[model samples]
Target chain A: MARNPIRDEIAIVGLGSTGFYRDSGGRSAKALACDASIRAIRDAGFEPGDIDGIVGAAEPGGPNPNEMSAALGLPQVTHFSSPMPVAVFALVDAMNAIFSGSCSTVLLYFAYTRLPWNSRSAAEDPFRRHHTLGVMPAPESVNAAAAYAAWASRYIHEYDARREDFGRVALNARAGAARNPLAVMKTPLSMEGYLQARMIREPLCLLDMDIPVDGADAFVLTRTECAREKTRNPVVVHAATTGLVGTNDEDQLPSLRRHGQHVVVESLRAKSDLWLEDMDIFFPYDGFSIITLGWIENFGWCPPGGAGRFLEEHWDPEAGCVMIDGRIPLNPHGGSLSEGATRGSGHIREAVMQLRGDAGERQVAGARNALIGCGGFFFNSQGAILRRL
Target chain B: MSEDVDDAALIERFPYVRIDHDSKHFYRGWLDERLLFNRCDACERFHHPPKPVCPSCWCASLTPTEVSGRGVIHLAMFLHQGPPAPGVDYAMAAHPVVAVELEEQEGLRFTSTVIGCPREAIRIGLPVELGWVERFGAPFPVFRPVEGS
Candidate 1:
């Protein structure tokens, strides 16, 4: 596959987010989007009228481009879209629009008005379908926690991984969250707390699930040269690729450690010149703890099923095994697991901050290159490599 | 009974269906106590959760055939707060759901609940056979552990 020269051609100049809350009572999704977008515009030193492209998850309660344009008063929106399901699709589309010269100075963000899973209205929705373990849509069961529980069960059965191993995943994220001022979860989560956490679905305790948060995160993307002139630091978008390996069959979608080829990593490598080990920070999607384990293994940080062992032996909030600095980090902003759910938008924002040396106390020291892997299911994988210029 | 009356009740019983021109037959088969799956005439491959065209061969010439209803539980979950089922209150009922890969093909997977087995007994690789049960006015296929399995 010929690599598009658009690699590293664009830069992210601004990142903004609302304070992630357990519940923003009566706050409409559009209001959250507006708050995040305006903050991003100012952070980029641009006005709403300067935004020429709009991209995000604009459905259910989110505002469409025209509505958002009217609300934010964007003078023009020549390129606009709201891709379905996966959050990474919006970011990738924004990058392509700029690459194709369709528009410049794009705004990309995500917001959600989450309803409780067991609420009368939420459970009774006819369209509430849950894809179990990435395949086999369970019409009778729309609780996503159940689907993840099944995946965790299979992972435990096949790999003999203990529950404590899963606890380590949650514990690590909480440790990272302690340093993040914007993280919704602040209290330290102990192994005992994780083990005794209420079981929403067997094998997936309450701590294992991503908390439903009401907030929005937005990013501003501009051409690399324009970004340098406008901002003191520009995080170059080295490469962003989407839809690496699709889940077409049940056998292809298991949450257990996959053997043989890791097509997602291969596709990511094909898009950029950076090797996996050179990254100063790793931000894999962590909507569920098990998904993070899969990424840790797939990213070649450790051998298959070695994530449990890796965390036990090498991973620490202050020290890590991957680099000479001893502080190699993942999810410096605490991730969706702790910082609250911005889908993968929070992951992208944090990566940019780390690269700019603007992450404050949680910042990885002297960080130059960062890799952000998005998407947690086998149905698709999206990722990008960002480097400071 | 008139077909229209029966269909109306089925629609009320299971409102979760995406019934359209292509998938109406699958629901109709369920009403007749038949669990139908689409088998592509060209590729001889079976498809679950019926689609208009075979994904592999893109052939619209497909036949709805009843499966053996025998398979092993690939994975199962015991939900403390399950999705709402007909006649069951959301707060009271906890469901044990299973994903069975049918014996007809390696990856022909379907979602159903396993009956007659304790939640503790449900585990990966447990053999199960399909059994029909009525929810509201609709008959749905559920699975149970095979005798002595």
Candidate 2:
């Protein structure tokens, strides 16, 4: 195993969210980002002057690191960067900056907004229309989002997986959302409702994909030494990693059994002193239900093509969600499906809350460890283990 | 052979595609109704969606080689709603898109919509041969069910 000196070295001291929404009610993405960042700083028991580093995910319409720092009136910032989204990239960047002493305190932020391509109302709005796809793409390509559906077809054919398997993932997310006031789609969903959902991309329907919304999540990170000195028991990053394989092309991906998710699982396992048996909560990304299944199987929660059956066996009908072996709850925060796509920021935020015992009604009793499998299977796959000490 | 086509004319031909220097040859092949993939001369392996160097051996000696455009469908999806494209009517029918695992090389695949076949027949493992259709007055590569397969 490669050395992981940084394991449990950094702690997330503060967390803030603008509470996801379908529309920001006229608030721009920059405005949402500033709102969340300010709250995060305050939650950390620090003022804007305490923040010396800024790392912002380069979300489509989100603000930059400097913009967030400036908007929040941070006095000075020694390190600032705009990493590509899905949360952990910025997390890793912030952690490295803190460890390397580029900055003592870092405010990592992510903001999302409904853009013209994804939302019709956003398209009609004059401000959002400027965010254009400079070059139109023919429908023949399976490059990005379309690849999930294309591969979901393969996943079904190869494993004889039914629509119900994907449905369960949606059902679980919806159930969690009902308890999560921050979520947008709180209406309880049944298996029948999911099966009959509108088929935007066949084999994967509207419920299979993440709901786009305007919101923001931000966090304050500092050295573990500082965190322990400030708080009685602060949650820390036990291990964090982003992974990719050589065959990253959506269509060219060798098969479901292998991809970035597998790499992430392997890397996290190597770095982490904690394992699934020690995990108190699980946050598998539900950007696409198929992606969640990929994490389930790739993380060795079950064998290949076994997530569908495993989820059924471990399903907590009372909770209306998957409670693994009647203990661990998957994505207690409603997740991207119902919680509005924070591009894994929602997952990270929820993990932080659960570890800090601040998850309100969704909190697991005495939660201590959180295993988050973030991003999709191809290029963006990431995983993290957060622990409270 | 395609050097005569200026960049402006090339972009005009494929207005929807963002063609850079590396992929110009591949898209240029589409204008001639020929599909091309970058084949590394050293290892003779094929890669798609065009990369500058061969992933296998890191050799920049690449050729935009044309294959038989014959393959089996490895991944398939239908779009009930999607981006606007010519000759596609999502309201009337679900448009099909497929990624075919080309026989020339393992895992070397090209993605396109299948035509001249019932939607039911468009599925994984379906044998297909490359075909062409016009989109915005330019050749668009497509797939069709291979005869007797």
By lDDT, the best candidate is 2
Global lDDT scores for all candidate models? 0.74, 0.91
Query: RMSD of model 2, in Å?
Result: 0.9
After superposing candidate 1, which stretches have Cα over 4 Å from the reference?
A116-145, A231-233, A244-262, A317-325, B1-10, B87-94
Tens digit of per-residue lDDT, candidate 2, span B90-111? 9999999999999999999999
Compared with the true structure, what per-residue lDDT tens digits does model 1 show for residues B1-95? 22354555555545666466676667777777788889999999988767889877899999998898999988777666644566545356457
Model 1 chain A weakest 10-residue run by lDDT: A128-137
Q: What does the lDDT read for residue A298 in candidate 1?
A: 82
Alpha-carbon DockQ of candidate 2: 0.91
List TM-scores for all candidates, in order: 0.90, 0.99
Which segments of candidate 2 are over 4 A away from where they belong?
none
Scoring only the second chain, what is candidate 2's TM-score? 0.97
